[model samples]
Target: MSTRRAFAAACLAACLAACLPWYSVSAQDVRANGQKQPPVSSRGRLPVTGCAGQPISDIIVITQPPFTERLPTRLEWVRRTVRKTHANTRDEVVRRFLLMKIGEACNQIQRAESERILRAQPFLVDARIRVFDDEAGGVRLEVETRDDFSMIFEPTVQSKSPLVRGMRFGDSNLGGSATLAAINWRDGRAYNDVLGVELENYAFGRGRNEFRLSAQRHRFGQDMRLEFVRPYYTDLQRYAWIGSLGGTREPIEFRRGDLPRNALTVRREFANVGAVTRVGPVGRLRLVGASLTREVQRTDEQSLLLTREGVIADTTDVAVPTFRPQRVVRVNALLGVRAIRFVQVQGFDALTGAQDVRVGMQLGLVAGRSILVRQARDRDHFVAANLYGAYGGTRSFVGLQAVTEGRYDRDAKAWDNFVTSGRLAWYFRPAVRQTTVVESEWSAGRDMRVPFQLSLADREGGVMGHRNSRQAGARRLVFRAEQRLVVPTRLNIADVGFAGFAEAGRLWAEQSVPYSISTPWRGAVGVSVLAAVPPRSRRLWRVDFALPVSADPQRRFEVRFSSIDRSRVFWNEPRDVQAGRERTAPSSLFTWP
Candidate 1:
């Protein structure tokens, strides 16, 4: 038999064995026998023990330090000293997130919602809620949570001398207040140096609104932003709003055929404000909203043009296009409907921690008109729409989504800058500790703006082995498949796993000014070593070794490392929607199934 076929056979056999009933005495069986069991709970542990309508006598919050009493004797001093320096999350923070209150009837839905809220906090490692029979004829509620080491300091290194290229340092839970403060510094090649600062508060005020501010400065440009939002914290929340102001002034490098040809300085400033309100029932919701936005952009071609060699070049000889300064003010109406549900699972995205999987359907639409325009184009009408649906079961899940956006120019009598994209994904679990995923995506653009052109790069949905090879285009398609297995770990500090993946993609361009077409299909196969620190962090650290599926002797293997899980396409929780932007369907919808 061939080597690849033999490997596949071995994997199949292992999966079959893992799916069998290996444990003779399961947790449910032990409970049936009236035996004392551990307090630890697994994913989706609902409060269904016939305590749904019981009155809550008292509410208790228990916060655990990072290091517990279950350590070895020799490390007692180390654990004690670390605990003394690291502050545990405050009880008030946990209490404010709870939906259940004392003296009120304990509802199972409220208890489940409260647990999900606590688990979503950045400082929390895990959270659990339990109900007990009270001595005074009412049920008592307990909220138990563990804290993570909130301080982070990561550095980027290179193989050459002066190894350190950049670094990021931050505190995710500043003073146990659930506030984030971070700073980043990078050694830029063309820009000389870069520095940035960011601050965010998840619970800003009495209403627990969110606030964020960021600023970055480099030799070539600077960016500054400020935002405040009051999001729907729960499925039944009635109203939400957001406001933001930001601007950017940066040098943009124009490339052709994957080679830098010219550069120009572009300046842009924008202000936006929006609001949304829920109008339908609790399980299925209809959202209505509106936004007003103003934006201005300008290009500076008079500035010295730099060529690929970093030498001043004549402006007349440059091949890059220069857009006229423009200003636009727009008002948009938004509408959406959603009916979604969540299920907690393990060994899917994270090796050990529970991951919330979202399932159901959502649809959204945004229609707007430019009320005012200056300098360049006449008033235009724009529209955007998105649709998403998913189905998740015990052993399998399937999801599909599509998005389209475009604008109609009144003067040109044609569509301008129209773009559309779609994605389909499927996940299957044959064993308790194993998962397999297959995903495909495609995107196309017509009359696209220069700065919005697409590219086939690692960060832009391309093969890992060809990350450094830039293949720009107006249309792209990619297919990916991966299999993951989690290994048992004896240590409590970390969880380890392994993954094997394959990817293939191609790109095509119509107008060749900004990007060139990549006619040949590129493919890669790779293996990854995955590990998560503190086990419950829900963040994977990966090291990948990829090789191109080609016979070219010039191609070599590539090694890449990343902290983000790029393969995860869907999330259980809704992402925060930015002001003046169309809400991402399914991901930003608020509803319960």
Candidate 2:
């Protein structure tokens, strides 16, 4: 037993060490001739005063491979091997995304927009566009881009005996074409076996439409989706459209107090098509669109037995009032206004990568009428509204988002599944390398007709140490705050950082359920080690150690590893509105224009 304990400890230590940031001498430390190098000034934008209206004389494209020759000699072999296998992005691919052309007059706004679009690509680490005087008196434009390590391999592990849980492998830039193809597989105690595949291309054809296809097979069922979209790729574009079809057949379980109380096999199918056009000036824009949607849902009577407190409990008799069969066709009108703005910053979400933060206000509303199939007289009216606003500068950022959606059944003459949610986030940088973030989220549901619920668990609303805590309810309130400090290092391969955080949340449910409205707030405190492969991957690798504030000794310590920073909030582009979805669908508050 002693020897086995020693072996386990060694294995755990090795695993943790492997996840740490790799350390090496910075490229600026020494010159090629072995002489100490001088520090360089910070990078800033070039002057655009006289070059704004000048006609472009020439266009030059420069691409950098992931591993450069400036690194130490010890990595020469690895660099050479990677370069041989990894294809540099095609010149045409970069040129096609550019808004400027030879002999065309240069505009600073277009140039800036081009840079933002190029940086948005997952395959590129950084992008810069500059204008200079040419020998022929015309302005010359230079575009430079650095490639990210396109190939990716991510694995999940646990602290238990079966340490290896799952893995995903893929190429974000297949053959330098800006295409993505990936596969994922997982088998673990908390989850059923899953296998999935995904394919996506942002520049599918001549118009640069986006295309995506995905399929997943679970132990009990499967799901598939296909989507094609011509998004507002640029602010100057006047039109956008989207078409999607998806279906799923799977078993869903409803749990309370860490145990499943009911299970049902559900099958659903949906299709949506929408189009929107810009309707106002560039400074103040309005979006108008309409969509048609069809949805069908069915559930099987068979119920799966689940274990409860070490005993198998037959859940067939459990009442699952949420699963109701329905077929509906709907039409919706979408209206939105945008006054959005952006600011570029470093070390906010991505360690050393350039990040664009969105600010200002965006509002959207969707109103629709649904016709129940096979029951011609049955009808319903639905409405959804989203609001987002933010203010960001060099030192501080504050954002607010809110959304509400529901349907009014004509027959019942009452509101069904009326739900509302809101979140507020604030970020403050006290020093150059230190940041503090605070966020609060609240959600409430009334007359809920579906199995949409909220929880204070880590994966749900993030009460860190209570990952498996099963406090769930129809009303939830959560608050989280974190402070982070970057540790300067010589290594160019990665950036390291440390953070401390505190989280508290409460859940409220009806008396008939396994929870109470008077449940006290639960809290946790934790520390994390954060690392990022700079100028390459956008994700941060994190390891957290947390402790619950409650009196349960068995839940004294909790450890977790993840690729995402839960404390940080990111800005996502607005999406087209669709109809016939439940109020519990993922909120578009932060994503709608």
Candidate 3:
């Protein structure tokens, strides 16, 4: 009845016809059968197949001479792009023709040198050509063609350039912490806020080759702080030296978050030097590497004997001079084989091997696949057996882990047993249909205690039902589901998305703790909405909001919001309640970070 309906009907009909499996004999075949037939071409080929074996008759005319340029351009690229691949039949030929035009347009953007040559030779205007012949050998088609062209000017390289500049800046925040297995925060507060900016230049003039640079300020959280790394080497071989002059803050060694709160803040100036080498994708794989950084800290006169609270009676006072060894050695090596694409069997070993001699080794297969990816279909999956018998982290035990990324972040921490894990995800259309993901992790090993409650009570200050020597073997299973909604691109922002999730887990630690992993096979469900906010421009924005109903006693309910920076109600800004009084959870945390 209407134009739109009529168009839809036409499209449907065309698609149905194209998809049908139909074969009809050609007129020539019919004729040879003594019925009736069409006339064959003079050359014993189809009329459309004229010049099936001859060379080109016309020259491929071009207006300019092709020359090497800093980047590619449009015109010279147009000639180099004629695809020789076969377009099987009539329909395919038409489709390939259209695609070739589109490819030419893309080349116009990617070929800078071609455009440069065309500009230099304004006399070279447009291009035209014709195919001379095409022949088939078995299933493949071979094409022959030719063209003539001309240009206006000669090319030159501006190698006399004296200098080039490079600069970059980055900022990051470490906003949450887990003490053992418990979240640590009253109001959400970021522990690490770091921003770094650097500017340097490369001088490429004759024999005077070396990098000369300087900088002002840089700092790294409460632990390690430094202002700059000047006199740094840019050479690619062995024995390259770099120097730095800035204030330094050393990180506490040989401990997890298990340290006393009465720690001293020591500050001083320092310098560092190092060297490195690699054989493959810089960040993906490596064959050999070593780095040695030494920092000489400066300090005013100070005392060394540290005392504990209230239990001290006598005092020894003296202004004793102090200096600390702020030096570290980090060496890593890869043996056998290593690469990004091909399978490489490799072994890695690293050691700081000093006072806090920490050694770690991981021997496992890291393969790439399209498992649990988002919209695009490819990612990394690793089944690894990692061992960390360091002062920090838990003591010695070989652990197994199976991890998948690009959809969800599974167990980053290792488990001390054989573990089986899987994740499934689908990225759906935004605004209407949303993405859904399901994930699980299961493990079996020697017996150990599985947590039920992180804190025994607000007054007890310990875990609930905790045993000193609990056997650790069990079939632990955790299942999680997540659904994400992409905020409509038709809305104010394009990249923002929302999500809702639920998690349930159970562990069978010998029939006693069966059907439950931590506490009563607990499940929690929550929803989140996101908005985009660009970092540098106020015009571009990103924002996300989430409300979680958690079974963890300490965190019964949570409301989270994030933009360029993140903020949460439970961790950043916690709502306090009376010990015995129970009230309905509030809709939001109005005063949180």
Candidate 4:
């Protein structure tokens, strides 16, 4: 079949499945068909359990009237007519009747649910109801308060502890100049100086409400230098308020503060504040809120226009680009129904063109398995799906993942194209209680792509910014594979584990691109030994040896890896260099086991 036709079929299937009733156990009831049951009294009650305080006899009555007098009495007759019938058709008759009865009962119960709820709450002394002149079926209740109303708006008690820690190590140049140096707290040692100092508190008021206020400051270097970075001193203050009205299902939060990632000097000056409220029935409420913020960005001085040869030329001149504070309203919803005892949902909205929104959902199935769906809509829309499942025990697992996204071009009136990618990891015992693992990833897009890890220059010169080469003319494909191993305990005196991995793959720049030279292929091999350490600390050290067999556009083959963290070394041409000039890269010490 054609690609278009295949895609259409998949979309149809997803829509149909989503529209079906998610959870209705009555349809699946089979006991009524195979066995007899005791009758209930006219007053409506169930067999009691535990004690009298449980009010077991006062079970919520859910009986309803029959829709049709001629409806069949047999279990089979009921199954076929109910809106949601049991998957097993053996008790088709009874399942159908029970479902219809449930629908009618829900309507009657919903009508008087509020009154029933008020009587159920033992703390309520009295309540007042008010209705708006323009609205119907919308009743507002004011729980009479005896204390001050300001106390009711206070914040709730919450976990507000902030942790900060850092470490430093250095080996001085020996042989020629070895002299005692003063402890300046610059070459590491001051664990607290490199990280930061943070204090937070969430105090509650007499009305049983709470709010949080926090502040933090950090110094990057011992000298507290302000070069390169705009702010020499960083200060941030945050505030969040939460209160629960007696009639509401959950606490309503009034947050006048910054998001975790929005910590910046400009944000503190402008200040962003918002409130969120739930909009669903009891036990289920969607969050609706808004925030106002000012965004600031620094531009390189080289990018600025300069006079050269009496003509304007691009020059780098740092300038802070500040935008007026803008208000962005956001709203989202979530729903939960116990079927597999898991829930999945999504929501997104940006009140105006100046803002954007994104959403994601996930479903966890029985066992260690899960499915995820995510989408982001801003300047463009992108969607992806992934699945994760674990099968092996400690130190081993078989993982499979896949994702695809499309970038839409408004001016072109069409999506640039869709890119699909997938990866698989399989582990096996290669030695006594030891293991060797193999993994591979593949991606295909519009003639310009490579595996994520192989994008050596992604930080500054990623594939997306490549200079024009011939159009290559069709979709491209990139593939990569790696195998790693762990040695047995007998290999080392201390029983330390050994691991090694090698990877190789090809990049197809175009449908016609040759699998050989035209498509750059590379391979790498590395080995490391892990030492055992204390249970609560990751201070365990590792020594690694890696050789890069692939040559970059610079025509250099390198062989270098680091200890502790793989950031201070690089392989370049004929030299294995130590990159101590600056932070060359983030520590690659955290990887999945």
27-125, model 1: which lDDT tens digit per residue?
111233777444333234334364578889766667776655444566467667756666666655677778877889988878887787676665676
In candidate 3, residue 30 scores what lDDT? 26
Predicted candidate 3 versus true structure: per-residue lDDT over 1-593, tens digit per residue: 34334334433443343333322221121222576343222343222332233332211211111221212343434424311111111111111111122112222111221222111111111112222222332111111111111111112223354222112221010000000011111111122222222222121121111222222222222212222221111111122223333333422111101222121224443333332243444213332322222223323233222233221222333222232222211121211122111111100000000011112221222211123323322222222221112111212112122321111112323222123232222212222334454545444322111111111111111112121212122344555566655554532112355567776544344432212233345345666554332101111122223222334433334333222211011011111111101111111101100
Q: Model 3 Cα RMSD, Å?
A: 26.7
Measured over all alpha carbons after superposition, the RMSD of each candidate to the real structure, in angstroms, is: 12.7, 9.9, 26.7, 26.5
Query: If scored against the real structure, what TM-score would every candidate get?
Result: 0.82, 0.83, 0.29, 0.31
Task: Give the alpha-carbon lDDT of every model.
Answer: 0.66, 0.66, 0.24, 0.24
CA lDDT, candidate 4, residue 185: 17
Query: Clash pairs of candidate 2?
Result: none
Model 3 off-target regions past 4 Å? Answer: 1-286, 293-338, 341-433, 437-480, 487-496, 503-523, 533-552, 564-593
Deviation of model 1 at 63, angstroms: 2.2
Better of 1 and 2 by TM-score: 2
lDDT of 3: 0.24
Please give the TM-score that candidate 2 achieves against the real structure.
0.83
Tens-place lDDT per residue, model 2, 136-170, is 65777777777778776888777796787788887
